[model samples]
Target: MALSLCLPLLAVLLQPAASLYNCSSQYERTPDNSDIIVECGTHTITLEINLCTAQWAGFNASNLALNGNHNNTQCQGSVDDSVDPPIIRYQLPVNNSQDNPCRQSLQIVDEAPDPSGPFSSFSSIQSVIITGYVDTPRSDVGLISYSTDLYYHFSCRYPLEYLINNTEIVASSVSVATSENNGTFIDTLKMGVYNDSDHIYPLVVPSTGLELRTRIFVEVKAVNLTGNFHLLLDHCFATPTPYNMSQSEQHNFFTGCSVEDRTTMTNNGLSTVARFNFEAFRFVQHRDRAKSSIYLHCILRLCEPTNCQVLLSSCNARRKRSLSPFGEETNDSATVSVGPLYTAREDVPNAAAYSNNVAPGKDDVDVAGLVVGMVFGSAAAALLVLGGWFVLKKYYWVGGRSQAFE
Candidate 1:
């Protein structure tokens, strides 16, 4: 009886330990008689078997699936091709969701030639799943549409982090147009972002003095804004001819020629649209020139509503005076004023005379005529004053003699 009890104890000790995981597998055959099998468990793996040679190719960690309701996090994965039948390993965080995590589905395509001979053809596609525990957070904003008059349009959705209530979003665009052939020709304009797609303008060609203007528009929408929020645009300026030359040379060539504007929006939600306008001018010498293109770089930002006011005040306080083409001093605020280049006249005496008359340069004839008129008028006034004084003296003398006789 003691011997029997010892035998039972030995059997219990010799029994194998329980497995940490279990695996499930499925298989399918290709038309060419190759077998493709997919297996899933704690680790997903796939295998392709050649029926003729009994050889096999395999892949591990091919796809991953994650639970839908998991905390937002970013995960990284890398492919190890150095090993036979390459594998992709995902480094998931330890705190990721255990049940129903997000997953990656992989499609494996076999394009390898048949080992039997070149005369035979065989191909197959197999899909495998590997569970992962990562979550992608929803974006706070989306870029609906961005269109150009040149018929180029780009639109997409991008995530905005740290978005909060009662905040402001601002977009400032500064586009500089530079000549591709020569570095001298350039023009830049800035304005409050807008969505007016019908505005057609001109950009000046520095070489030929021709106008060539292109407008830029920007629209912004708040994904899910709440409370008292605002959308503002500020501090937008463009350097049209930012030539590759020295700073002084560029300043002299441009001569403070620029356009600027500011706009604000107080509405809530995605209805708030802020549009920006920019006109670019590049100088190309050839009249029937080859195709030329303009490059524009812009920046868009978001901040608190109170921050917008502070920025606006700072910009205003730093304002400087700029000279216009007409030699008049104007306020260099973030505003643009468009006006006629020259005054029109009904009569034309002669080509040269009309040109001289309308020219902005000072005229010697006008200065001489004004001076002569002033001298003659002054002499005539002096003579009239002397005559009036003589008449008064005679009347006074006669009256004095009469008083003496009395």
Candidate 2:
């Protein structure tokens, strides 16, 4: 009986030495299998078999770093192998003003690819917005033209289609001689979510996850001699085809995606400064669904002066690859007065002409106050100098007449 009790205690002690911490090591168990084993000195313990099978079954990270070891990351690649055509839309700056080509600029608000919430999708048409301001009464203004290259991060798995027979990634090209033209282009790359039955799509790693950035170059020019023209630009997320766009839906997808100039020319030619403030949102309908709209609360109004020179003429243009998670603000208003105008010494310069056509009686009080202050300051300074000179004369002269004062 004592021997049996000692045997049980010895077994317990041996068990701990054989499998104390229960940790495993990576070791090949078979031709297609692996095993994790634990060892303590001469004792061997089988901890687990095929432990990482589940993780590698899907695109999973070996660890949290997503190093492609487990093949868990979605593939990153282009949407197609060819370039799509360009689309252009125009809104004149002023009614009845001579039409000019509209200018455009593209700004990428997000680099993450596809399913940018409900407000974004996987189409080249979904990536650009067209917005501009109208010139007022005097309509001679420049034609606005916009062109940009879409920069993308290439995934070995899902390479984007190129422009010329799969030779490049430039989308369609467009040019408008004037802003009166209108056209539409829509192309979709059925990402994992929007894939149609036509093409064999590959698994794509999210472009955002890779932290890629894209930009569009835009230019706005003065085509004519119009100076009082104010130009603004904005964008709307392209409506997904086969998807009905409602009034609310239109408002939803374009959330916070507008920009405008912040100053204007008043009737008197003085520039009225403007401020641009905006907000953006991700509008949803089905809560978990991947389709929604973006909305931009855009107001292009005048603001207070920010600098000495008033706003003459302002224009804003932007092109972005990513949807605006939040819209942008631009201070494009310029000084319109052509020359300096004087209203009782107040230099009121015209932003457009820089000429002085001062309004009478407006700045007279200020000028008079300035003059009074200057006169008082000059008198005080003169008195001080005179007093100092007299004191110096007395101190240097010993005998009033000062002939060496001996």
Candidate 3:
């Protein structure tokens, strides 16, 4: 009984201890080839170190050193040295097999705090110096040399002004054009009196004022993108309400008249300009000869390309239209199915298989005929030899002419 009790206590004591230090790093190059920036991060801190070098250099994580100022004495932070080794220890030229020149950045993250725990928050950090060593050898010492010392003088937290100033919408480049019959042909429509700076396009109602089934095309342009980002239109909706209402209020009023399309943005230029195009169906309802307009609503979001499927999971856009005057207001929702965004001639279904199954060409037919003729000629020659042997045997043995001549 005593041993059983001791076993549980021993297991609790033998449990593995959690790590206390983590660190990650990324590299970037300036446009003018002036400096290479190294971005390093831990659980609580991030640092950007600039090195003035044109050639690629190596970084050894084992040589990393950090000093923190506490009570006028410098304390060295202890990093967890038991982690697995990183795959890359050196940066090389673009033509080299290991590194990509076009990729100007790298990012790594450490999950645990330093062993010394010098930092409690961004404001608590006083003076810290991080030194990194390059893997290159020195001519005299025959050892690795120090690259640069990065000093942290400012607050560790990212500035609020940088976030606000870095991202903006390009409103001037936004435009719209409509194509009839699901983009089969282009039929430009005149801008109605309702066209204004805020709205994407004007809702033009024909003289008949009946429900005109037509396609609406919207194009949005955005710039100043950082990292791998993709643009998406959440959904398009139309309501029988006035246009003066707020976007949130309008969405609540026309909850059931939304359409979802599989339209994704394309990168038009070098990661700077993003172009988005989507087609929506509009039904211009007429009430008592006065043209009634349906206010359209759409949601746009920029997200990491890999997280698109996760972001779209909660999207409640409906594809099928309701038979009732107002479309289905039920909570049931589904995502629209779509083919590949870009299609090539070779990507067509059964294209290669169909070509292979086609009848043989003239040259192929001629070669096949020659092979068949050769096979038949050989069979005929064998039959003639057998018949000659049988006839000679019958004449010599049955007629007995050879014995009379002797």
Candidate 4:
């Protein structure tokens, strides 16, 4: 009985100590080239540390305007016979990678996780978009040279002051028009390339000034990307019973209790820039079934660059009616479902399965077995000594009985 009890005790005692040495680390960077490194150690080890650099890529965003047409009461595009709105698409470019140049030492939690709230994480976003307009009917003289503001006006339910302030959201803007020379359609001329935040592209000429209305195409580039940090194995416990498990499991409910640091990024010193310039310019003449109304299409392209690995791209839309060629804005609303965010590369490639220092130590299972054996041996020796003492007492008692009989 003693040996059996001690064996289990030895096994339990040796198991935890053998499973030690757990840890994790992460790196984050901002647009301005600043960095934050996080590391946590579970067991003790000392040595030089090294980490590889990661890449940073460009981010993208959508205008979320109902229909690309700013059909508000202010300025409006021409009205058309058909109900379908016009089309407007935007694109943006992003950088590829980020580098990690340093390392640090840290300590991490080693105990088993609590049933609830053991880890927590967060994400930081850097995004940009382009906003511009195209006018029809060549506003200026028949020469096709027109001077006006390429206004893009739209409204959003949420405040958008920050989205509008970034210059990188607006790429280069230039005019494109077909030129006629010697009774033949010759090359094209692009001009009026200027930046105007108050509202305008400053186009000197419209495309095909002859048509009562012209189709102007403005290219808008947008970026919306993110970074995240994660932490693990922190203390977490369910609030004592009597509370509804379903409704109260949320992170907002618990107070004083903290969560594990799963994934996180710093917002300071990191800047996001969005710029767009009219990359392509074209004008279309009014055809049959076309009317005074300008078809405005607000195309939303949503991309989730998961953990900066694979990407998920989708599109949504909104519509508006421009009162002027491209001026007046409309109160129309639109929502785009970009879908769930993508997951990043969580695991490092080809990383060692176990720590190098851990290899030097003996196997945990072997050590456990040895400890169990020793515990059992001690218990057995004690039991044997007790049995022998009992036997000796019996023998002495029998001898004393015989002597009395004699």
Candidate 5:
């Protein structure tokens, strides 16, 4: 009974020390590129510190770990002070690796995620934040309290951003048509419009434009392609006619970049599916024209399990430089078209244009009906003006006669 009581008391006393253990440096230094070199692998991550360089940064370089298991001596690396430069190296698995406790450093979290993906991870190239601590805490850090730690940290990044030379990057974009050229046809893709944000309700647009400023939720998907790949869109726009280079256009997104303020590129290169939303708009040239139609077109490509996410981000960086298409160029991009949709008025959504209940008398207002209503309204206005003039004339004449009698 005495031994059990003592054991519980001992655990309580040691809990704080164990919890407080962290690899904070002896002193803080301004972040620099030469601080440490990092290597990110397919399933593992390696961190190396130079003894000569770390000494100037005041790194504490002690009590390093490679795995959570205390007995996993194969992973635990050595720290030697007697060496000339005193190099320290640690190799461990990434957080998402199959080995649950094998990773003792480098915790990665996704910055971009896809909800409906077949793979265990939503995207091949996901934005992630990798964090790890090096060395034990010391009093020289200037903070006396245990609530704070001065461990080394870096901002969120893509897995392929600093990958170990295993993947190739061929990220280039140019304007191209997604139609048949030289008898080449691309039938591996599909594009559609949805009525809800969840993308569950398919929206069937009119044969011509849609309502002004209605949220046009769109989704572009890859069909028969296999393996891990991401969809990269070069351009998507609304043209007054079938997509020819010779017409006024409103860009929903250009090169995976949003041009309109309300346009949201919710998912790009995140999975096999790419989703975006834009407000419905009529072409400036066709705003006053009735019976006009709008056509939607997009040019997109598929990226293998490499740095596609980073590639899309690069497109966003130079968005302003490539706004207009100078000429047509061709690559692996596929073109898909939707719509010949027309908008009737602000009151009607145009989806109700061709319903079974829409009889000729209820929905169709011919030119004759409009002309008769205008003629009646104009005649009524003229009669009201004549009556007002007669009343004023009679009142003034009566007043003058009364004054003469007085």
Candidate 6:
């Protein structure tokens, strides 16, 4: 009996692992499968498995994706025949973007360092999770959609920010994954100038010369951010030269207040796009220059979607009632500086022209017309009265003379 058992075990070990697959259903237990192989690299996760295993289970490896979220990821297939049973390999890139192309999830975990903890280990770790799914759809089950979708999730984790030794692991090709970068958060936030209040037409310089009181529509947007963050404008001001705030700074708006009441704005804390408009103006100290450039700098904050609106409302309310200690405000703010906004006091309406074309909605009583009408009416009334008196006198005098003649 012992000899027979030993012979059977040797035969089983010699057999190809692919032919021994005993998949219970479409739901594959990938991690437990001795045939499936995985290697976690610094920026990539690669997986290889027997194609026959997937084929026999009525699932296509090409159709399987990292997260089952089709928009975020797609699988490409390649075959290797060096071994007895052919294997399919997928190189999954660990990436972060508007669409997490690999559909990797992220987590931050705190860890207590062990006594033998290496210097390279961190007290807290951030990890990227990679998951793949093999699903089988049964059409016989009337439109219940995925009613028979048999799938199981298989995943691996790499605590990011830790250095890795690439020499230990070998690969045929090394495709670099786009790592999530918070370093250039400022670069991703863009500020722009527009001509129309609706932000339709762009404000072109030289062609559309900056004149005093020219409405300049401005917009700041999150261009490459995948997370939802509301942008809040703490203050926006213009200085004479680029980045020299020590020079005369002309403030357009501050803490939600339009300083001169000459600005129009949308809700800053409710959208990723923060927008406002102020008339083109010259720096006070640089007003004498033939042409000067205005540097616009804005102090802004990016807040979580949950707290932005309420926080903005509270701060603005305080600002409206009275000035607060501006420096003591919350700290997660970023500053953006846009320079060389060539502004020359051109196309300025002279005082005389301005007075002549006074805007409507003013009490403009015409004094000259009133005086002319009054004088003409009085003179006509007096003339009529004098004529009536003369007529009466003539009548009386004529009658007396007739009596005397008689």
lDDT of each: 0.29, 0.25, 0.29, 0.23, 0.50, 0.52
Each model's TM-score, in the order given? 0.23, 0.16, 0.25, 0.17, 0.37, 0.43
lDDT of 5 by residue, 152-254 (tens): 3322222211100000011112222212111111344567777789988777666454667778777777554433346655456666666554444544455
Candidate 6's C-alpha runs over 4 A off are 1-184, 244-252, 256-260, 319-337, 346-406
Candidate 6, backbone clash total: 0
lDDT (Cα, tens digit) per residue for candidate 3, span 1-406: 9999999997776442211122233322321221222322211122222221112232232322223222211122222235321121222111111232212222211222223321111111111122322222223553664553333222221100000000111111112211110110001111111223333554343443323333333333234333333444333344445332233332221111233344333322222122333332223333232344344433233334444444344334534432111111111111111111111111223433235565446558778999999999999999999999999999879679778778
Best by lDDT: 6
lDDT of 4 by residue, 1-406 (tens): 9999999999997654323222122322222212111111111111111111111111111112112333432223222213222112221111112321111111111222123321111111112221222222224556664333222221111101111101111232222121210010001101111234322554223232213322222222222322211111111122212122253422211111121133121110122211122212111222222221121111111122331122111101112211111111111111111111111112225644367534324567667889999999999999999999999999999999999988
What C-alpha lDDT does candidate 3 achieve relative to the native structure? Answer: 0.29
Candidate with the larger lDDT of 1 and 2: 1
| True-structure Cα RMSD, model 6 | 16.6
Error of 5 at 157 (Å): 32
Question: Where does model 1 exceed 4 Å of error?
Answer: 1-85, 88-235, 242-274, 278-297, 302-406
Give the distance in Å from residue 372's predicted Cα in candidate 2 to where it truly belongs.
93
Give the per-residue lDDT of model 1 (tens digit) for 1-406: 9999999897776442111112112221111222222222111222222221111111112121123322423222244445433333433221212431433332222233233421122121111112222222223365553311111011111111111111111323222212221110001122223225542323222333323443434333333332123333322222222222122211111111223432222321222233444443442422244323332222222223564455344433443423221111111111121211111112234444445566433566777889999999999999999999999999999999999999
The residue-by-residue lDDT of candidate 6 on 171-262, one tens digit each, is 11123222331122344456777788788777766734477788887777655443535666655666565543234455545544434477
lDDT of 3 at 295: 45
lDDT of candidate 2 over 1-406, digit per residue (tens): 9999999998886664333222233311221222111111101111122223212221111222111112322211112112121111112222122332322222212233334322233232111222222111222355652322111111011111111110011222233112122211111110011111221332122322111111111111122212332222223222211222133343322222322222111121123221222122223342343322221221111112231113223212323632342212221111110101001111235544223555545567668999999999999999999999999988877556666555
Cand. 1 TM to true fold: 0.23
Q: What lDDT score is found at residue 282 in candidate 5?
A: 65
